[model samples]
Target: MKYEVVIGLEIHLELQTCSKLFCSCSTTFGKEPNTNCCPICLGLPGSLPAFNRRAIELAVTAALVLNSNVQLKSRFDRKNYFYPDLPKAYQISQYDQPLAKGGYLRIETDGNYRNIKLERVHLEEEAGKLIHSGESIIGSDYSLVDYNRAGIPLLEIVTAPDITCGREARLFLEDLRSILLYSGASDCRMEEGSLRCDANISLRPSGSDKLGTKAEVKNMNSFRSVELALNFEARRQAEILVAGGTITQETRHWDEEKKLTIPLRSKEGSSDYRYFPEPDLLPLILEDNLIKEISAALPELPAARRERLKEQFGLDSSEAALFTVNRSLGDFFEEAAGKYSDYKNLAKWVQGDLLYYLRESGKTVEEVDPQQFIELLALLDAGEINRPVAKDLLNEMILKGTSPQIMVQKKGLGRISGDEQLLPLVEKVIDENPGAVENYRQGKDKAIAFLVGRVLARSGGRADPGEVNQILKEKISRG
Candidate 1:
């Protein structure tokens, strides 16, 4: 019997706030261990927690972006648990009264768009990081805890089990990250641990509505890892079911290097947390006026931007999607588009050559001047320099931040467009290659292309290809 894989993701995003969620401690990353902690963050005696107002605003903004309905009165609750990373012995999080709920995000996969419904977007504090000296946490002889990440504000986005496969899961996360970055809510940097994901997946018989025993897979640091881990877990569960064995519901860790999921422990249910409403903090009351302000302040999201790039700029869906994934790159393209007349050529340079140079030189779009890039495109348009020279000049400009025109003049990289200078070289190429000339005369049109390449080779890539082709066609036809 064939089976279908079901996946749901619990994404944790650390909000871009200056301070901790319920304390005055710094939220800066890469600090000395425990250096950013304070009395409240460290959970010392006689300390009380105070919520950060900025965190609330950013959270509400994110909810609005995701189309979630923000609750007017949401309260915090104590999630009772005992762990080494939790200094408070219980974490302050939202239980029954979350900040937002009933939202969905659309993802395009397999040439079809589908909406992945969101379960909830709640507020919580991050736990500390655990450092293990040995290969694995279970094998470590000693461990260390860094509380710098503790008490940091985190937004938990829980999604429904609507994803049918691993590829869909990866697409959803990519789109979600783009949305988060566009909103300025979080950086969503997976390497820095600012954004993390844990997937719950199961495999049931095809066309069955009953959910199978699912496993929660953790330690997936990247998007690729999430997809691979879910695939492995789904296959493992399917094999067990096919062999008439039961799949135990447990929490598993994705061993990325080994490409397998190792069982961590039994999965915990809601009753295990022993949750209750916190007494220290009052219920969060969002005014209607504030919601309206946030909604109005929302920028054009990724989906809308993609569509606009396609319709307004004449970019295909793939090109538009590629440009809009990085907000800085998209802004650069838009700024250049305002000045350049050729929209398709501008898109090609930005998406193709500009992106390639940026990656190779270890630079960003901000490092290059838009005016300088526009000047380069203008030079190409005017036939002042050929494409090869323009590409080399672009690389130089990206590396040294020099002017494209100045470099072209200094290096003598101007295109040999004048027919007076190029006619002799075109004549030389035609005289030396009699076989190609004969082939062109005999109706083999591709032979003239060979003669043009010879003329360009003799000109050191400085000759205008269009002029060479025109001159060669005229001379070959005359012969």
Candidate 2:
């Protein structure tokens, strides 16, 4: 019997705030371990917790962007757990009354769009990291706990189990990340552990309405790994069911390097993490006007902006889609292209030249130097270099941060556009390549390739092949 995969995602995004949720400590990443922890974050006795108002505003702003219903009354609950990572031994999270509910995010895939119903988007505090040199959370070594990440405000977005396939789930995540970046709520940098995902997946018979035993997969740091982990789990579960073996409901570990899921523990009861309302904090009451204010502040999201870019810039669907995937990347393209009349060439240069250099240099588009990119585009417009030479110069700029003009000078990549400078090279190539010249006169039309090669070799590949080809045809035809 064929099996169908059902998947749901729980995405956790660390809010981009100046301070932690319950204290005034820095929430910035990359600080020295435990340097940013405060009394409230460290759970010192007699320290009172105050909710960060800015954190609430950011969370509400994100909820509005997702079209969620902003709740008038929301409360924080203490989720009790004892771990080295969680400094308080309890995570202050939203349990019953969340900030938003009943929102739906529209995700597009393969020219079709679908909605993933939101269960809730709740506010919570992040745990820190435990770096151990041993295996299985045990064995020989003592672990170092970094409490800097603890108490950082996080938004947990839980979705209904409506996803049907791994590919659809991946698209949902991409769109979700786009929305997060566009909203400016979070950077959504998965590699930095700012944005994380946990997927719950199960497989059932194709025609059955009943849900089967599901497994939760976590520790996937990238979109590619999420899809891969889900796919592997679904296949593994289906094979077990087909062979009449029972699949266990458990929480599994996603071994990213191994590209497989390993059983972590049985998913049965939550006995230890006793959750209760914290006596120290009061209920958060979200006002209607406050919600309205944030709702009004919401910008044109990815899909709407994509449509606008396609229509306003005269770009195709695919071009617009490519540009809008990353907000900063798309902003750079428009910042460069919108000023000029020929956005088509700008699009081509960005996707072809800009994207190529980013790959070659192993850098992100955000890490690119906008001034150098603008200079390269300006050179292409000013006829300082031809297409291939411009590409070489761009590669040099990316690899060495060398100025494009410097590359042109040092590598002799300047175009020979002027006939005065190009004619001597053209004439010399014609005289020496007699067989090719003879072939050109004898109507072996493809011999133009040979003449072009001779001219380029003499010019150290600096001559514009287009001009050389044109100059050669004319020189060979002279009476």
Candidate 3:
């Protein structure tokens, strides 16, 4: 019997606040171990927690972006647990009264869009990092705890089991990350551990509403890892069910080296945490005007931006989606398009050549001047320089941060478009390749392309290709 894979994700995002969630300790990463700790963050005696106002504003902004219903009065609760990374013995998190709920994120899958329902988006404090001596934590002889990441503000976004496959799970996260970055909430860097995902996956009989026993998989650091882990877990569970075996309800760790899931321990439920309302902090009461202010302050989200890019700039869906993923790149395209009349060419250069060099040179759009870029495109449009010359000049511009006109003048890379200079080169090409000239005269239209390439090569890529083609055809027809 065929089975259906059901997956849900609990994504944790570290907020971009300057301080910790409940303390004034620095939230900076990569400091000396435990250097950023304080009494409040360390949970020392006689210390009390105070919430950060900036964290709250950013959390509310995330909720609004996801279309979540913000709770007017939300309170924190103590999640009782014992772990080496948890210096406080219990975590202060939201239980029944989360900050936001009942939201959705729409993702495109298989050429159609589907809304992945969100269960909640809550705020909590991050746990410290555990540095193990060995490669695997399971076989580590010793471990060290770093409190630098402790008390960092975290936003937990829990989604319902709306995802049907592994690819869909990956796409959902991609779109979600774009939204988070666009909102300036978090950097969502997987390598830095700023954005993490825990997937709960199960396999049930096709067309059945009853949920199967799920195994929560952790340690997936990247989107590709998440998709691969979910796929492996789904297949593993399905194999067990088909063989008349039962799947154990446990927590599993994704072994990246092994490329499989290993059983860690039994899964825990809400009762296991022994949650209760915290008495130290007061219930949060968000005002109406504050919500309105946040809603108004929100910039254009990814979906709306995608649509606008397509309609306003005449970009196809894929091209628009590509540009809109990075706000700066999209802004660069718009700025250059405003200066140049050809939107399509501007979009092509920004998305194609600009992105390529930026990645190769480890630079950003901020480092380059948009007006100078438009000037370069204008030069190409006006036939002042050919495409090859423009590309070389663009690389230099990206490296040295110089203007296109200055670079062109310094290198003497002007286009040889004058018919007086091109006709002789065209004649040389026609005389050198007698066979091609004969083929062109015998009605083979493609032979002229070979002659044009010869002329361009003789000019050292400085000749205008259109002019070469025109001259080559005129010379060939006259003979």
Instruction: Say which candidate scores most in lDDT.
Output: 1
Residue-wise C-alpha lDDT for candidate 1, range 199-266, written one tens digit per residue: 99988889999998899999998999999998898889988999999999899999988999999999
Candidate 1: stretches off by over 4 Å: 423-454, 469-479
Best by TM-score: 3
Which window of 10 residues has the lowest lDDT sum in candidate 1? 410-419
What's the residue-level lDDT of 390 in candidate 3?
A: 91
Can you give the TM-score per candidate against the true fold? Answer: 0.93, 0.90, 0.93
Clashes of each: 0, 0, 0
The Cα RMSD of model 1 versus the native structure comes to 2.6
lDDT of 2 by residue, 1-479 (tens): 88888898999999999999999999878999989997899999999999999899999988887778889998888999778898778999988889888788998777787988888999999998888877545363788889999999999999888898777888888998888788889989999998999999998888788888889998787899988998888888988998999888889998876888998878756555677887899999988898888778877789888999898889899888888885676888888774666888888888887887888789777766666777777877787777777887888777778888666777666667668988999899887888888988999988999889988888766678888898888877883
Candidate 1 residue 82 Cα shift, in angstroms, is 1.6
Please give the distance, in angstroms, between residue 195's alpha carbon in candidate 1 and its true position after superposition: 1.1
For model 3, how does the per-residue alpha-carbon lDDT over 49-166 read when each residue is reduced to its tens digit? 9989999999999999998999999989999999989989988899899999989999988789899999999999999999999977899999999989989999999999989888
Give the root-mean-square deviation of each candidate in angstroms.
Answer: 2.6, 2.8, 2.4
In model 1, the clashing pairs are none
